[model samples]
Structures are given as C-alpha cells and as structure tokens.
Target: MTTAWMNATIYTGEDFAEAILTEDGRIKQVGSAEDILSSSPDRVVDLNGRFVLPGFNDSHLHLRHLGKQLQSLSLSGTKSIQELIVRSRQYLKDHPDRSRVALTGSGWNQDQFSEKRFPTKEELDQISSEIPVALTRVCGHVAVVNSRALEVLGLDASTPNPPGGIVEKKHGELTGLLKETALDYLGPLYPELTSEDLRSQFQAAFSAAVELGVTSAQSNDLSGSNTQALAIWNLLLDMDQKGQIPLRLTQQLALDTFEELDAFFEEAKQPPSDHLSMGPIKLYKDGSLGARTALMQKDYADCPGERGTDALSDESIRKVLSWAQENDRGVIIHVIGDGALERVLNLYEETEDPSRHGLVHCQISTKAQLERIKEIGCYVLAQPIFFDYDLKVLVDRVGDELAATSYAFGTLMRKGVSVSLGTDCPVEGVNPLPNLYCAIARTDLEGKPDGGFHPEHAMTLSEAIRAYTAESAFQEGHADNKGKLAPGYLADFVVLQHDPFQEKPDALLRNRVVMTVIGEKIVYTHHGERSTTR
Candidate 1:
C-alpha cells in the first residue's frame, strides 16, 4: 500500500515537513506536497492544513483494568461519604445480580471529599451488610471496604498486618482501609471473568486507544492469578494474529514467581509480531501519594510519624533485580515516594546492568535523585496528568521542599534522563491532549496557581510531545523504528485540528484528534476528507 498525506504541517521532532509518503507500512519519504504529488503512486490524503505528529505512546497503563473501569460504577467525583454511599446503593439497586458477587468500584479520593478523610466501614455497610464491598481510591494503592468484605477476607483485630501493607484500624476497630499489599488479598475475592469476557474488555480498551490517537501502549496485567494472567495474554495474542487488535501492545507481565516467569519465557521464545510483543516484568516498590502509602524519606508533613509503606523490602528488590539480570529480562517497577525511589535505585546499582530496568511513577524525587536517574540511564515512565489531582495536596503531604521538586519533568529532561509520559488510565483518563496540557501548564484542570504549579519545572510543547512519543518508543525498544515521522519509521501518526506549538497550553485540552493512522491504514477518522486508491 502506497499513500501520500499532503497539505499538512508535519512535526517530525527534528524538523517540520509539508507531506509524508508511506509504502508497505513504513514512511517512504517526507518532503514538499508538490514533490510527494509528483510521485503520484496510488492514493493521496489532503489534510486541509491540519497538524500531523507521531501517534501517542502511553508508556505505562493497565489496559484490562481501564476496560473494566469503563463498565463499573465510578465514584470519581463524589463529594462526601454520603454521596459515595448513595452512588453505591443506587448502582447495587440498578444491578440486582451484583448482590451475590463482591461489589467492585474505584476512583474515590479523600482529598475531594468534604470530610477530608477515608470512608469508614459503617458508611459502606449502609449500602449492603450482606454483600462484600470494595471501593478503591483514585491512586489505586489504597481501598476502603465494608465490614462484610473484612469478614469475607477473614481479616480482624487478631489478623496481623501483612508485610509492606497496612490494614488500618483505630480504637482497636477496623476502619476498612487497606493499603499496598492488603489489596493483593482482595483480588481472589472479586468475581472472575470468563475468556470471552477478557476478550471483550481488551477490545473496548484497544478501540478507545486508537480513538485517542494512541498507537502504542505498555500495559501491566496486575489482575492477580497467574492462570488468568496467562489466559488474558493468550487472548491478546489471538487477537493480534487475527488482526483484531488496532494498536501495538508491549505487555509488562505481572509474574511474581520465578516459576511463572520461566513458563512465560518458555512460551515466548519466538520474536513478537508488529502488533503484539512481550516487554518486561512488572513489579511494585511502593504505593501512591494520594493514599499516603508511598514510602517516603521522612514523615508526611500533615501526618507526623507516618512514613508510608514500602511494598518490597530492600533484599526482595535486590533479588528481583538479580534474577532479571541473570535471565536477561527487563523489569519495570512502580516507585512513587522518594524513599522507595532511593531503595529501588540502590537495588538497580547493585544489578549487573542497571539500564535493563525501568521506573514508573517517579513522582516524588529530589535533585540528587534526578541526577542519579540520569546516571543510571533507566527509562522513567512518568504521568504528567497526575498533577491534576496530586497538585491539590502535594505540599500538605510532602512539605514545601519536596513539593517543589515533585513531577519534575523539565528537570529530568535537563539532566539527560529519558522520561516518557503515561496516564496510568483508570487513575486518569488516557487522553494525551490533557496529559500534554498538564506537562506544559503544570496546573490543575481549572488552571490554578496563576502561572503554574512550579512553572519552572514545566516542559515545553516539543519536549512534552517527545516524552509522549520518542521517549516512550525508547522504553518499548522501538526508538529507531517507531516514534518519528521520517523515512524508515512506521507510518503511525495523528492528525489534529490545530498545531500544538502554535496554541496556548489551555487550548491543548480542547484540541481534537481528527484522524489516527497506524501502519499506513486509517484506523480512526473523526472529521476528515481523503482520496484513496488501491
């Protein structure tokens, strides 16, 4: 297939061009529209002076979870515990069949609530004393459950807290809050989905990705249960073979044991296809800032003597890194707090090849840590969109000194660190436009703080775009072949209504993606006219 996209302002990262020509699923040439038209091979697309850039690459997110969230009840914007209970009750009332199964929902933030605290078991028990209820916080690190859920999990005052997790209690009574490792136990309690259900979930996620101009994603299947994980993987592989998957997926398998890892490697001996590939082993070092569960160097400013939980011990982290080095597999760990970052970095230093590992959610870091990240040369999968909510409570959680350096995108780039952008979807939406706006504006959704929250750390338009594209491609080991629009690169790009560089930061959020092309095929087209031929 040969196609020419003309009358477009193409941002190739290094240079701007007027047209791009593709042949056999790769960019054949980039030049003036007249020059591209002179070739006149097969088809032509008049972009009507639209802005064309490389398709977005969300470096880290949970694909299947995003799909499930799309179907589940959302408590994202609930203003109080009363509202949460009301919504949950209504949802239960609407779906009577869910009464038998554990009620699962997410996206509630304590900061957003009027009471400024987590909901208690008593409040949730009002929804249903018979059925188990588990409501996850927006950060995905903590969850609040009802009394029945605790009983179902066999948790009580006599039950000791697991390592690297917390089962919150006050006055010798359970508060229904589960942090870090506590969430691991609740996985088995939730209802299991069938193979057909898994396929439907993935299909919904892939369709959303393409519609949002996301050409590639690095997904972590942290759904628990090795059996279900492998089943979902097989379903994705099947979809890719049948050309049903629209975007490229490089999976970060969540295998906790060496046995599972060995089995996965044995089955994945062959090279990956264009649409599906196995990338790295996924691990968690700590939790999120919102839940106050991220391991920090010191106590939280607002909550004294409370340094957050560390999901893995230093020895465990070292062992995992060593195993990855020995097996020649890369590991991507979720490290949020400065303390967790330090410990994970220390383990990386001990590893034979530090570059073989990547870090996710490098949210809270110091200048020294940023330097170390640059020196280590590991990929940093960051989510700029987090600022929308994290900025609201940053100073209160980490104090002024640490808050200034939080979400330091520009500083990392200046230190020569490879930083990529992601949404961690279900925590935040997978729309790259708002993410780009956050990276540049460094402000909340309403555009607060006058200029920006630490505007000094805000990235330029081009820099943010690069992080979402080339840097993400680098993390997926497709740097040379996929991220740019030059010759020899994959024909994956998005056409937008306005040039991002020429627009204000706020305007970016409102800008729409007109068309999305992957492998030289138009996967999604919202509003565009084109001429085509065989």
Candidate 2:
C-alpha cells in the first residue's frame, strides 16, 4: 500500500520536507507535495501544514507499574500529610473491595508536604489499622508502611536492616519506613493478577503510550519471581503476535541472578516480531536521589555523614558484567549518584564494553564523569522531567557545585556522549512533551528560574528532540531502521499542532499531539477533524 502524507512541515533532523511517501510500512520517498502527488498514490493524507516529526521513544520506564498506578490510589500531587490521608480514605471508600488486599499507593513526596517529613505509620493508622497500607514515594526508592503492613511483612525494631537497604527507626522503635532493597520485601504481599487481568493492564498502558505519540518504549517490568517474570515477558510477546498492542516494545529483562539470566537467555533465543524485541538486562547500581539513598562521593550537604547506599557491591557488579560480556548481552544499570557512577564506570572500563551497557538516571555526575562517559562511548538514559521536582531539593541535598553538574544533558551531548530522554513514568508521568520542555527550559511545569536552572547546561530545541527520538532509538539498537524520516525507515511519526522549533520553551508544555502513526497505521488521533485520509 502506498500512502502520501502531503503539505506537512516535516522535521527530518537534517532538513525540512513538504511530503513523504510510504509503501509497505516503510518510507519510500520524500520531496515536495506536488512531486509526490505526480505519482498518484493509493492514499493521500493532507496534514494542512501541521508539524511532523519522528515519534517519541521513551528509552526507559516501567510499563506495568504505570498501568497499575492508573488504577491504584495516587497521592501524586498531594500537598500535605492531611491531604494524603484524606485522598487515601476517599479512595478506599470508593473502592471498598480493595480493603481486603494490601493497599498500595505511590507518588507521595516528603518534600512536597508542608511539614517536609515522610508520613508515619501513626499518620496512616488513622485511615485503617486492619488493612496493610504501603505507599511509595515519588522516587520509587522509598516507601512508608502502616503498622499493619509492618506486621504483615514481619518487620520490627529487632529485625536487622538488609544489605543495601534501610529500615528507618527512632531510638529503639521501628518507624515503618523502608528504603532501597528494603522495599523488596513488600513484593510477596501484592496479589497476583490473572493473565486476563494482565492483558487488560497491558492494553491500558499501550493505549496511554500511543495517545502521547510514543511509538516505541524500552520498558522493564521487574516485579515478581523469575517464573513470573518470564510469564510476563511471554504474555507481552503473545500480545504483540496477536496484534493486541500497537506500540513497539523493547523489553529490558530484570535478571537478579546468573541463574535467572541464563533462564531468560534460553527463552529469548528465538527471534521476535518487528513490533517486539528483547533488550538488555536491567540492574540497579544505586538508589534514587529523592530518598537520599543514592550513593554519593561526598556527604549530603543538609545531612552530615550520609553518603547514601549502593544497591550492588563492586564485586557483585563485576560478576554481573562479566557474565553479560561472556554471554554477549548488553546491560542497562540504574546509577544515580556520582559515587555510583564512578564505581560502575570503573567496572565498565575493566570488564565490559560500555557501548553495549547503558547508564540509567545518571542524574548526579561531575565534569570528569561526563568526560569519561563520552570517552567510554556509553549511552546515558536521562529523565529531564525529573528536574520538575529535583530542582526543588537538589541544592540542599548536594552542594551547588555538584548540583550545577547534575542533569547536564547539554554537557553530555557536547562531550560526544549519546544522551536519551525519558519520563521514568509513575516517577513522573509518561508525557514526552513535558520532558522535552524540561530539557529545553530546564525548569518545572510552572517555569521557575528567570532564565532556567543553569541555562548554560540547557539543550537546544533540536538537540532535545533528537535525544527523544534518534538517540533513544540508538539505545535500543533501532537507530538504523527507526528514529528518522529517511527512505527505508519505518513509517512511524507524529503530527503536532505547533512547530516545536518555532515555539517558546514554555509553549511546548501545552503543545498537543494531533495524530500518531506507527507502521503506516494511524494508531491515535486527538480529534476526528484533525486527521483524514483520501
């Protein structure tokens, strides 16, 4: 089938074009509308001078968690502890059935609260003492549980803190706060959903992606045991084979042990469909900055003597990387602190190929580290939207010297390191526009800082777009076939109402995705009148 998308303002990275022709799900031609129309294509789409660019590709996120968050109790924008309690009560009142199950909620930040403190077990006990309650902070690295949850998990003041994790306590009493690996204990308490239930959740998540013009994603659904993880992977593959999902998926397997890695490799040896493919193994080198759990070179400015935590020891990381190198598999690690970045980089230099392994959330780094990243030729997966919240607390956590170097996308790009942008959804929402805006503006949604936070480190609009598109595709080994508008490239692109390059940084926050096309099919359209094919 031949389709001509005409009279469009196409940003082809290197240049602009008036039209593009697609045949059999690949771009066949690019030129002026008149030139394309002379061929008398089977179908013609008039974009009416709308903006067209390669579809957004989120390099890293948790798809299943995003879907689960959509249905669960969310304290995402709760401003105070009282508001959080009120919302939790209201959710339980609305969904009386969830009372029996472990009540799970996410997106509460202590920094956002008026008291600037994590909600305690006592605060949550007011809502329910019978039901086990666990609410995750926005960073996903910390969680606060009620007394009931602590009892359910068998955690007490006598219980020792697990390696690479924290169980907060005051004096001799447990405070019901868990950090890093400590949160893993809550896994068994979650009720398992049936395959049919999973299908519904996956469908909801996939629909959400396309609606935001996200044609592709690299997702890590890391919950559950090895058997369950494999099942989830197979289920997603089945969905792709059955055409139940439209967005292209690159699954980042979360293998905790060598045994699980071997098992995953055995199952993933088979070739995947065009829309689905197995990606790198996912690992966490350190925790998140929000909870002060990220391993850092120096102590947090506000809290003396605290350098955060490392999820994996140097020996463990070396072992995992050695295994990956020997097996010819790539790895994507979650590294947030400068200390973690330093350690992981040293390991990458010694045992593995940095190009094949990516650093996720390289949020805190020095100029030296940035130089090393470029020299090592590894990909940096960043969530620019993190600035919306991190900007509020970064200076206090780390001194201004470190804070200035944090989230340095422009510096990374200038240093020749490939940087890709993602929202790390459920941490921040899965909206690409806001992320793009953050990259360009270096400010929160409200547009803080007169110029922008260290505007010197800000990326140009074009650079930001490339990070969200071509650079993201590169991370998944799809740059050759996707992420661009050249001939032979997949016909995956998005149509927008405003030209991103022409609009001011703040204006992009309101920019709407008018239409989304993947593999020559219109998967999402914001309004009927905005899209038409003849």
> What are the lDDT figures for the candidates, one per model?
0.86, 0.87
lDDT of 2 at 393: 84
Which is the leading candidate under TM-score? 2
Clashes of 2: 0
What are the per-residue Cα lDDT tens digits for candidate 1 across 1-534?
A: 578898889999778999999999899999888888898758888788899999999999988888887777788889999999999999998977755588889989999999999999999999989989999998888899999999998999877788878888898988999887878878755677877877788888888888999999988863365656677777887888888888888888877667667676666534268988888888888888888888899999989998888787777667767778788889988899999899888888877777778899899988788889888878789998998899888999999999888789888987788889999997899899999999999998889877998898998999999999999998888999898999999999999889988978999989988889999998998854453333
lDDT of 1: 0.86
TM-score of 1: 0.96
Clashing pairs in 1: none
Candidates in order, TM-scores: namely 0.96, 0.98
